[model samples]
Structures are given as C-alpha cells and as structure tokens.
Target chain A: MPTPLYLATAVAVSAAVTWGLRALPFAVLTPLRSSAVLRYLARQMPTGIMLILALYTLREVRPTAWADVVPTALALAAAIGLHLRTRNAVISVLGATALHVAMSTLWPA
Target chain B: MRGMRARGGARDFAAAAADTASVGLSLFPLGISFGVLVVHAGLTWWWATVFTAVIYAGSLEFLLLGLVASVTPLGQIAVTALLVNLRHVFYALSFPLSRVRPLGRVYATFALTDEAYAMTAGEHARSWSGARILWMQALCQGYWVGGATLGALAGSLIPITLHGLDFALTALFVVLTIDAWRTQRDLPAPLLAAASFALAALLTPGQVLPAAMALFTVSLLIRYALRHRAGSPAPDEHRHPVPAVPAVPAVAAAGGEG
Candidate 1:
C-alpha cells in the first residue's frame, strides 16, 4: 500500500472514533429525562462549537494568502443570497462552494 | 405542543426532503477532498470513506487530517474530536433533533454536521417530526458516502492542488449566517455575532477558533441574559412576517403531513 493509503486508513479510523464520541451524548442523554441544567447546557453548546469549527478552519489558511479571502467572502455572500432567496441548504452550500472554487481557480495566486 | 405541521403538504415535504439530500450531495466533494487528502498523507480510500461516513463532522473531519498525518493515537484523536464537538450538545438542547427519530444513538450523533445542525435548527423552530429530521440525516449521509468514494478515486485524475479548499468552510459559515439573519427579524443575533467574532479575531493568535468560541459564548450569554430579563419569546414571535409572506406558511403547509 502507498503511504497515502496508510494516512487514509488512519483518517478513516479517526473519523469513526470521532463520530462515536459525538454520538455518545445523544445516545446517553436523549433517552434520559433531562434536568434544567442539562437543558441549559445543551442550549449553550452550538455557538461555541460553531465558532470553534469556523475559526479552526480559518486558522489553517495561510495569512499571506489574503487574496484567498476574497473568494471565501464571495462564497459566503453567495450562500447567503441563495439561502435567503431559496431557503434551501443544499443549494446554498453547493452554490457557495462551486462559486468559491471557481473564483479560486480564476484568481491570480 | 406543536405536533406535525398542520399545513405542510406531502409533496412539499418530499421536495424539502429532496432538497436536504442535495445538501448531503454537496458534502460529497468535502468528504472526497478529505479522503484524497488523507490518502495523500498516506492512507487508503476505504479508511477515508468510512471516516467520512462515520465521523461526518466537517470541522473535525479536517482536523482528523492533521491528527492522522502526525500519527496521533486513535484514542487521543477521539478525545479531541469529542471535545471539539462537545458544543453540539447545546444544539440538541433547543432543537427538534433530540426528538428526531431515535437512530439508536450512534447514527444520530455520527451524522451531525454544520449543515445538519442548520437544517435541523430551522426545523426545530417549527415542529417536531422525528421522521422528517431522520430523512434529512439519511440523505445527507448518502451524499457523504458518494462524495468520498468519488473523491478517493478521482484523487489521481484531478490535479493535486489544494488551492481553494480551505475557504470552503468560511463560505459555508458566511452563507449560513446570512441565511439566519434574513429569516429572523432579531437584530441582536447578527449584531452580537459580528461583534463577538470581530473581537475574538483581534484577541486570538494564530488560531482563530478558540477566539471565535469566546465570541460565540459571549453572544449566547448575551442572548441568555436577555431571555432571563425579558422572558424568551416563543420561537415564532422572533420571526419577521412579511406582509404578504404567503411563502413561509405556503412552504410549511405544502411540506407537512399534519
């Protein structure tokens, strides 16, 4: 097997493990009747998680490739535009990704 | 208790479900891109696809690329992803997802994604049909499987350029944020999000996420504080009704069984 294949295997395994961890709360918590505290905590989770996810992704992008920021910004604009007009998630994400990709390919590095 | 939507028609509901499936389809590129990246880092497609289908969380999926490349132990990777996705717990609290057709815990948690969260978050605001929610998850997962598979195979066919992949997440967030802003009338949300993100960006170092989380936490706290002082409005109360907003109810009416 190639070196990439080894990495792929690790990734696949990691993904599985990660998914299992995520599913734990739902499996464990969903069945149980929740207390006020449980409910309160669950309510607070998304924004923090989402912020972490988005910021984490941005951190990896090289700061000097500031030009790359434009396509993503445009993609966000496209996603918002499509979503507002259509109220559809698939279209919004796809349109944004495609447009962003196209822009990246076209933009001078 | 809000049961199934009273006005949603079967056809519209199906259409909406189909629309959801497409969202998953979009995930295909992401998944495949991830798979290809992993393989390049030295893994196989099987492992890549499995992870894409199994782990399924977008941010964590990317993060896994780094962990795997560095030879991090599986246990360690698991622990980190769990911590990263810990925030999803909050999502299930208020949304209809916790009530989504119980998929034996594993499937429900495995399938959660930003798109999944966004879709279900909107659904929770309106009703609690576990079946509809499950349909969305299943469809999204399907796209993930297909996308990863194709991406792994095409890894060689496509040039090995990583040009625009990184920005995809930002675009996705921007899109979702805008969508949330337009649908609801509450100005506090976007305003708060902007203020928080900007401040977080300024204070954060090379890593923007923890900073963003700080901002998001502040926004949520602000909202939570407001709720305590003003009493939270009914979900529908925050919605801005366009004078002739037949579209809102029309979409819902055509989309439900009840």
Candidate 2:
C-alpha cells in the first residue's frame, strides 16, 4: 500500500464512488419518478446545495484580513456580476479566477 | 437496411460532434489548467491522466488533488466525493438515459458529467439516440483527458508555482450556484441555504458539510409541506419558462417521467 492507499486503490475508489453517484438517480428512477417529495427536492436542492458548497469552499477565509477579504469579496462579486451580464459560465469563472490570481500574485494578499 | 443504419449512425455522430464543439473548445483549456495544477501540487503527471480518465468528475477531481497529496482519511474522501457529486443524482431525473438502449445505459450513466448532461438533457435532446448521447460524452471526455495529458506533459517540463490556484474551485461553485438559482428562478432557496449552513456550522462545528446538507434537506421538506398545505406547490414567480433557453431543463423537467 502507498501509505494512505495504493495509487491504484485511490484511483479505483474515487472512480467507483463517482460512478456510483452518477448512476444512482437512474438506478432508482422507477420509484423516484412518482415521488412528490423527491420532485420538490429536485427543484430545491441544486440551488440550495450549490450555495452551501460555495460557502464551504470559502469557509477558511479570514473575514478580518483586508487584503485577502477585499479581493476575495470583489472576485466573488465580479464572478456573479459577470455571469449575470454574460450568462456564460466559462467567461465569468475564468475571468474571476484570473483576476484573483493576478491580485494574489502581483498585488499580494 | 444496412446502408440506412450506417448512414444514421454517421449522422448521429456528426451532429453530436457539432453540438459539443463549442463546449469542447472550452473544456480543453480548463483541462489543461487542471493538469498543470496537479503537477504544481506535486502529484505525478500520471495522476492527472488517471484521474481525468477514471474519476472524470471535474471539480471533485480538483478537490481530490489536494486530498491525495495529504494523509486525509479514505473515509473522508468517500464522503467528500458523495457530497460533491450529489447533484448528479438529481441530474438523472431528466437525463435521457431512459431513451438510451438498455445496454448503453451503463456507460451512458457512467459518463453523465455536467458537460455531458448539459449537452444531452434538454428540450432539444428529445430525438437524440443512445449512440448520439454517448458520442457527445465520449468526445467531451476525450477533450478533457487530452488537454490534461498535454498540460501535465508541458507543466512538468516547466517550473511555475502559482498560489491561490485553488480559487478556481470557489469560482466554479459560484458559477454553479448562480446557474442553479437562475434555472429555477428561485431566490429564497439560496437564502434558506445560507441560513441552514450557518446554523449547521455553529451547532455542529465538526461535520459541517453533511450536517448542513441534512439541515438543508429538512428545511426543504418543511417548505414543501407548507406549500402543499397552502395548495399549489410551486412558487408563482416560477411561471416563466424555467429555462430562458432550451439548454437547462434538467431541474424544470425533474417533476416528470421524461
């Protein structure tokens, strides 16, 4: 074993887990198709979970640090604003990431 | 009969390629960036190919690049994978896998990536075949894997170490949040999410992700019950076509057998 896992094990486990998640909805679609509760969840969970997931990614940022906070906040705003304007995921995400990367490297956090 | 079958397959292949060309062009560069990031994070180049080839979940793979470099417990990795990929479980609600011939369903489901789903599961895909959907997904994966391999090969030869690269994941989630909100025209859901997550974080301290998801799920169920009691279960503002365009019906169509 490669300590935590053999290299192949890590690959297989992640692959298996991902495949299982992707396949799950279809596997159970017969029963799930008629459930109103599941229907509500399908409508509700994406936006809700996505918001939480974004926050989870940023959970560690220190709210008090001006240099980091300013850029991080601005980057998020720019991302959201740019997406609203363009309705394009690629431009908004890449453009915001590029702005943050430049700031972190040149402007310095 | 043979000639017609051959021609239909060819046309399906070409149409799928054309439908995916623009998306594929963008996927290539992002895949390259993923490859470069993997090497910069000190994982071997083969790790990039193995991950893109096998796991194939784009953002989760980025998260895993960090985990694989550390001694993060395998149990945690499994949980993280579940949370990150949970959205796909819903994508299946409207994904055209049911239209796919039974034998192809397994591979089709395996490759049901965000890119693949976005391309294939929409109002326009009503007439698409299992073979066409399969091709679109395979091409998307090829572009991703090819770009990642190229990026790793080139990245390994260079000495660039970029900090704050992890910000890509944050940017990605933000994009998804905005899309999910726009698709549903649902503003309150995100507010409820913020509240649920904050409560979970404060109350549980550890186990925030799963705890928050559970809290959010409960909140959704409560909201659903109230709406049902109130009569008519959908928000009024959601009367506008769920998609501004045809490309985003997965959530809107989720309440159906289609």
Candidate 3:
C-alpha cells in the first residue's frame, strides 16, 4: 500500500489536471467568444462530435464477433426508435440498456 | 421584492431538479459500481467518496482507481487525466456557460462533465437560467457522490451480479447523438464522425477517443473551408436565426454528456 501522503498527492494532482482542462475554455473563450472561427465551430461541431462519441464508444467491439455486434445493433436501434417515438432521453437510454442487458444474459453468445 | 426573489429561486430550483432527474438516475448505478471497484481494489470507502467529489470526471475516476492501486506517479496520472478529458475542451466551445453568473460559472466549469454537458446542450438549454444550470449540475454530482458512498460502505456485501450496467453510458451517448442530429439536421457532420471513428479505430486502437475527436475536428475544418470556397451558406444561416440571448454565440460551445 502507498503512504497516506503519496495517496493524497496523487489525488490532488489528478484533480488539478482534470479541473484545469474543465476550466481552460471558460478562461480562454471569454475573449475569443466573438471570433468567427469559434462561432462557426460552435455551430458545426456538436452533431459531429456527438456522432463521433457514439461511434467511439463502440470502438472496441469486434465485427467478427456476433455476440458483441448483435446486441449493440439492437440496443442502438431500440434507443433511436424509442427516442424518436417518445422524444425522451431517459426512457430511450433505460429502455435500450434494459434490452441490451436482457439479451446479454439470455443469449450468452 | 424579496418575496418575488424567493419565488423565482424556488422556480429555478424546481426546474433544475426536474432537468437532473433522468441523468442523475442513470449516473447512480455507475457511481455504485465505481465505489465497489474502489473497495475491491483495496482502497477505503472514503477514498471513493473523495475521488467522486474531487475528480468528478466519471470515467476517469474509474480508471483512477486502478492507477491509485498501482501507485502510479503523479505526473503520469496528470497526463492520463489530460488525455482522457481533452474532449471537454471541445465541449467548452458550445457549453452554455456564459448564461451563468461569474461565481456560478466557476462551479459550472467544475461540474461540466459529459452528462451535464449532454443535459444542457439541447435546444431547450436556450431558456435555462444560471441557477437552474448550476443546480442541475450539483444534483447530478450528488447522485454520483451519494451512490459511491453507499457502495463503499456496503463493499462486497452488495451483489456482484450487476452485469452490463456500463452500457448506460453508451445508451446515454446514443440518445444525445440522436437529439443533436435531429436538431442540426447536418448530414456531413455525422458522415465525418463515421469517417473519423473508422480512422481512429483502424490506426490507433487503444487511443480511439482522442484520436477520433482530433480527426473529426480536422474533418470539420476542411469541410468548412470547402464550403466557404464553394460559396455555400452555413447550415444554420437561414432556418434558425441566432437567438437574441447576449450570452449565446453561434450555437453555444460544444458541451457533451460525460
């Protein structure tokens, strides 16, 4: 086990770095808020970033494996369908995740 | 005047609470899992609470438990934290922080996790108050901190059969992506996202998150340059005139669900 001082230092270091990243934009962007480039990026970046995040989350899934592929595909479809129908993020995420867990348990492939 | 102020405060609290309910619920299970992992990794329960309270960056905290267990160097830990969270820089580009008061903005920055970002990024975020935004973020953190504390105290006494709970994160992202897509109706962005994902997955399998984000940003800039040269109007040029909110600038900065 590490010493108490060492543990505390590690936590403090981690916190400082994490908080720095979070705070950087607010500090830097205030002045650049009116810049055309930042404005354009603000308009164009969200959908692309969200899409990238969704795909990135599934990056580890191996296409050759049916076990990983099938449930993810089903859950994604369920999420999209539920979201479109109800327009509620909570219901969509919960409903889809439930379906995914159920499939994983039952199939076990 | 005091009575009116009290009434407005109560209304803002209600709005923030209502907004946080779903996101908070989803975070609970993950926080419990994090706490359990901390104990299983030989850390004390309070350590779990401390990490949740201080770090507050959801997935990174999970990774931190492992780093802490191994007695990783502080410099390495800091670098890892930076890489894992570089995406938040992009989030700041659109996050609705300017609406928040200066004091609240400090806390809002600290609380700006992926889930908080996702909750606030939608079209509905246009009308939120600083109070509502800050409270929603605080409630989300409370769910995480409370769940982590509970799980730590319970330790291995809690059943270990909570399989597939992590998918909540993925499901959350999927829902947010759909919402963003519906709002923007921007085809090229999604396509670029797919292209970036493919590139990252193919080239740098282990570091997909940052790799994909960098590629996506590059792709977006290229697309912007091409469209500018072709004399095409920007996507939101005609349909959605910019909102009159002084704080809002060009679709706000890119905050996402962590």
Model 1 lDDT, residue A20, Cα: 55
Please give, for residues A1-109, the per-residue lDDT of candidate 2 as tens digits. 1342455666677788889878766656644545657656666666777788788878768899877787789889988999889977778777887888887787565
Error of 3 at B223 (Å): 0.9
lDDT of candidate 2 vs native? 0.73
Q: What would the per-residue lDDT of candidate 3 be over residues B176-221, giving only the tens digit for each residue?
A: 7877777677787788888898898889876777888899888878
* Candidate 3: residue B84 lDDT (0-100): 78
Tens-digit lDDT string for candidate 2 (B182-226): 567667778889998999889986567667878888888888888
Question: By DockQ thresholds, what CAPRI class is model 1?
Answer: acceptable
Candidate 2, residue A106: Cα displacement in angstroms equals 1.0
Score every model by TM-score.
Answer: 0.70, 0.79, 0.89
Q: Runs in model 1 with CA error above 4 Å?
A: A1-56, A61-66, A82-92, B1-16, B73-76, B97-103, B123-128, B157-162, B198-211, B226-258
Better of 2 and 3 by TM-score: 3
Q: On residues A2-28, what C-alpha lDDT tens digit does candidate 3 reach at each position?
A: 777887888788788877888887666
Model 3's TM-score against the true structure: 0.89
Per-model DockQ against the true two-chain complex: 0.29, 0.51, 0.51
